[model samples]
Target: MKKLRDGPMDGDMNGNQRTHNFRFLLALAILTPLVVSMTVMGLATFHFGRLSVGELTGTIVQQTVARVGAQLKQLQDVAQDQNRLNLKVMADRPPRAGDFKRVAAALAPSFEVNDELDGVYYGVEATGEFFALLRGTNQVVNLLERTLDPDGQWSRRISRWSGTDWQFLEQLPADRYDPRTRPFYQAAKTARATIWTSTYEFWPHRPGDRRTTGVTCATPVYDGAGQLQGVWGVDLGTIELCDYLAAIDPEVPGYPFIVGEEGDGTRRVIAHPNRNMVIDARTGMLFRDANGIRDETVKAFLRQIPGRFAAHAVHTASHTVPLRLSEFAPDSVAARTRTFEFADHGTNYLGGCFVTGRDDRLLIGMVLDKKEVMRHVNRNAAWFAATFAAVLVASLIGVFGFARRASRPLVELQREAHAVGRLELAPSDPPLSHIREIRELGNAMALMKTNLRSFRKYVPADLVGDLVRSGQEAMLGGERINATIYFSDIAGFTPVAEQLRPEEIVEHLGAYLQAMSDGIAQHSGTVDKYIGDAVMAFWNAPRPNPAHAADACRAALANQRQLDRLNEQWRAAGKPVFRTRIGLHTGPVVVGNIGSEHRMNYTVIGDTVNLASRLENLNKLYGTRILISETTRAEAGSAISARPVDRANIKGKTTVVTVYELLCEAEAETPEQAELRRQTEEAFAFYQRGDYARAAAAYREILQRWPADGVAAALLRRCEELAAKAPPPLSQDG
Candidate 1:
């Protein structure tokens, strides 16, 4: 005290005040051990936990592969047994066309013995007679019979088992289907033993019924003199296998697929988690290549597997390893297992491959994305780390209770200040302290936080940030800005809402609104408000976007694309699809905070906005998805592909706006889209020039090409009405 200086010491404004370094040193001393312990603990825990999880994931994949192999082997055994049973019943004699009833009686019990059998059939090689007992998804059993009449005409009849007796289902011409030409029959005849056919599309029971995929295990029935008599076969549908794969660890996110040696001796996908991927849509045949896989993630996983599991080139040179799995049963004749690891796009994956079949022919592959594996490990590790840190903190608090209590108010004040700086102004209780100054500061911060939170709730965060940075208060006012306004409404929303419950409507509309908002926000547009199923948004408001028109158009396109994906998902889930129509216009509008002194909304309003709303409603009449005014099309020139639609007088505006249908991004226009534009424009030209008959003809031609062209249909009807009332056109020569 006696050595107090007249001037500040050590850069302090006052010499009477003690330096704060002592408090800082105390904190450092208390925190040093805790920090070091946590850092070391985290590193060690992650390192060891990663190693353990790696092994665990590998074990899981291997076990899964083994499980699938066992299932496939069991199926093979069942098929062989069924074939043997059928062969013994046939007794080396070919069944006649008239013996179908006897064959059906013999095979009906086979379904009772094994529910997995989709079909059991016998094909006679000499007489070209076939008999099949089949089951369907409806729990109905069908008996199919084919006979080669003496006149060489193939007669086919289908009958279903109606619990008590056989009921005739239908009769169809069987000229296209011959058992001798089928792979299942040809394979067994060539091999002269039991052989499994590649997966193929099963014949549909009736027209418009969904077809199924199945593999046939066929055995050649030989006479005692070594002459071939007939082929006996059992069909195992892959739908059950697909369901089984889906049921395995339903939460795991990883999927399994089976590729097997087919009847053609080439490997192809036999079963997949997605039933659609296992069969070709165009030919109704089993998919033969990975090109049919739609999911990029699944495709990436498939790319790691080789065409043949025996090939050592399953991975790149650095990651390549011999295919071996010693954990598999050592004495199992049909089981051959392999494990491999590789990196794709910086993500490591663990995969296992197992071959199990009559000749080790079927390959089963399982892939686990390492991130999913690590996520589980890291979650557990995080709990451990948090618990360890909490323990250390509790110990320190016990030892230095008084000191911490004294400094707690200041710490809370600092934290609150930082949170306020980040605009996270959630109300928190004021920190208590014995020191009056600390208590006062805490109270002041609490007060500021309360006021700021209320302020934040009332105003846009971006606008608040701008005003705060400029050190200005927001006032009720308006400024004219050239902005692109967007308006969108769900088509047929009333009926859609009527079909849903209250909670369901909330969930459905919430997702739809979120998707639309995301599209607008992604393109630098501001979402102003939602009016039921309608969205009102604008670009170049609080944020200045030079390419506002282009951005607005892009947002509209993006919204439609996202809606398309959402519709597909909804359709598959058996939910109603939301179809939306959007309108865009670029013009000057007043954008600012508007309302009375107590309430305010940051939005845009003007004739431009009204015009956009009108354009959206016009889409109903024109049958269009996106309609943009002439001003918007001009401003967004070369940024979007658009075709001239019509010139219409907006409801509230005096001027007529030439509207255009927004198609796609300029660079994304395809040849077909270009052709559509050309044809539509040609027809529109005729209608525009009062050539009603020619315009009607052109629209009819368009409808012939695009049968579902709603726009063409709408315009064609208008042209037809105009042509009927008009005077007959004079001949060109006259």
Candidate 2:
């Protein structure tokens, strides 16, 4: 009994088995139930967590699928309504055989049904009686329009050879007695009401040519008296529908298909994922089986059908106890399952489902990885066992000295481990464990913390923390933002860029960017993107501010100020000086990645971005260094002093944007400049009144005060030109 008790810590034992020491063995014995219990609890917690997560995920997927299915089903309802409306239109008037030609002509533009499709047609209840054909893609070809009664009072077969392009079919007789043999005629007679038929291939004969088997939809015509008259039908190539479904996922090599058993095993590839992969399903429906993707994935995917999995629960039976095991493939989506150590402070049972679909919805399963669940499980099992073993060993020890010394090393190791997390010490601390195993653990932890700080270097620690906390900025794909766009291009950048060496150019650009970065940050603007010589800046973040536009405007002006200072320094050093022009516009844009997955730029894009660039180009025309859009002006409110530059209808922008030039702070414009601006506003008033003569005179007055003002000079030329062709100025009421 004594040997068995001292077996693990026997001093003379070899090192291989000697890893198990007396005090440590007792600790492990106590920890055994804890570890086993932890493992079992982890499994249970993980299962429940997975159960909840999987249920929620499945619910979301099912709801989305149900929604899309409902929308598609709604499409069928629309088709029914359209068919009913066409029937109503046909019932209103029964066209006589002679009236058929003229009626088809008048109804040619009628889109009473299938607005997105080629065209629509109608047929008669009487077999071979009332028949008519119409063009599908472009025009209507009169197929048949006679009430065919072979020996009736006035049999009309005379117009048979008229040759008005009904080319899809073999030329028809004017009055046909046996039209029931024909597909459309036969189908119409049977339906006697609005009816949709299987895909047809009958060609409507056109000028000197013929059309072949095409999908046709027909509806029986009725008169206002509630009488069934004829059937209306439209014929189209089935390939069109196939083409449409094919566009669902252009990247997927997997093509879509329309699967169903219809009409004597006459299968047809009615539709496909993309137009490029269309197969005539009617003749050759069974084609692709490569990559084991044929019968199951392809067919099931095409039908958008949910699949079943072999569900199972297996309880692991060990010598000590029987634990539980559960698994099932409810969907093909969660294809791969993996086990991982989902541990922070303790071991845990975790199952990672790898699936693909919409929004990672493919891998959707029950979330079984909650911290509290794992915590409860690990503590109950692991902590219980460890404490039990510790107390048991405490009872066995003859005195306190061995127990104290034996446990001291572990306690010290734990303290050091805790200290590493708090950054209280560098990771260079050596493991102080006299035992090799404890020493190895301490060494590994120290190395791990050392590597952790390295990651914090590349990405700012606070920024990464912010991203993790605000799940919205999850460092995956970016989002759209209503931001102010700023485009600044050095006026002589092309010349300066050409003149400078590559290294010098980079240095110059870096300096310029650094300067601009300081100003943009000062005004709460995010430098969204830079286009070589042009700097694209925006306000609103990673964070938001109601003063985004104001910040953007201020940044643009500040950039101008920075450029001026830089140019002065460059000139003093006898370097080529340059001027920069900036344009700012505030609008909503898709601000996200603008490059390949491996390499990307976080930037903004939309019509607003283009408008900002356009406004930047207009800088030379206005002779103003900086321009702000009407939206920017509005956002900045009355805080910044600005003069209305023009009411120009910028290209691509339908509504005229009132362009403004930022002059100074609201309280900072000189009196003379303010007066000149007032005069400029008066000139704009005259410009709106169509009094070009007066407007031109006012512009001349401003030019007299500031002759170096090119804007006044340019406006004067336009006003003078318009004045030569002007109407008299309007009175106040007028």
RMSD of 1: 20.5
Q: Estimate each model's TM-score.
A: 0.42, 0.40
- What is each predicted model's overall lDDT from 0 to 1? 0.77, 0.57
CA shift at 233, candidate 2, in angstroms? Answer: 80
**Model 2 TM:** 0.40
Give the per-residue lDDT digits (tens) of candidate 1, residues 213-236.
778889888777898888888888
lDDT of 2: 0.57
Summarize candidate 2's per-residue lDDT along 510-538 as a digit string, tens digits.
Answer: 88887987798788777665678787777
